[model samples]
Target: MITSMREHKGHLYPGGISNKRIGVYELPDADISKYQRPWRAA
Candidate 1:
């Protein structure tokens, strides 16, 4: 359930969920390219 802000002209904006519920949620339609990796010491 990718929810977003619906403007007058039907504009959708991806947002975050506060106190995210387990049953209902929406995956933002955005770039999640960033990832977590172990730190490498030089």
Candidate 2:
């Protein structure tokens, strides 16, 4: 089984999962767009 994940717009979200055989099929790449959160000075 293959698990996928993606991060976009400052939040992380689950993309998808595949349970197919690895050798017979090509695996997809995970789409991810990570954002940096701003920190406030105390």
Candidate 3:
């Protein structure tokens, strides 16, 4: 199992996940645009 999260437009958004048994994969990078929130540290 896998889980991840990201911030976009000042809201917490779900990030993508991939599972492969016979292939290679990479985790997606976090989105930076409009990710800054007033209640969280930068």
Q: Summarize candidate 3's per-residue lDDT along 2-39 as a digit string, tens digits.
A: 46655444345454356432222334564556545454
Q: 1 or 3: which has the higher TM-score? A: 3
lDDT of 2 by residue, 1-42 (tens): 436644444444444356433222223453333435544557
Which stretch of 10 consecutive residues in model 3 shows the poorest summed lDDT? 19-28
Measured over all alpha carbons after superposition, the RMSD of each candidate to the real structure, in angstroms, is 12.1, 10.8, 9.2
- Model 3's TM-score against the true structure: 0.27
Worst 10 residues of 1 by lDDT: 5-14
| lDDT to native, each model | 0.39, 0.42, 0.47
Estimate the TM-score of every prediction: 0.18, 0.29, 0.27
* Model 1: residues with Cα > 4 Å off, grouped in runs: 1-21, 38-42
Which tens-of-lDDT digit does each residue in 1-42 have in candidate 1?
A: 544442222233444466353232344554334534533557
Pairs of residues clashing in candidate 3: none
- Model 1 — TM-score against the truth? 0.18
Pairwise lDDT winner, candidates 2 and 3: 3
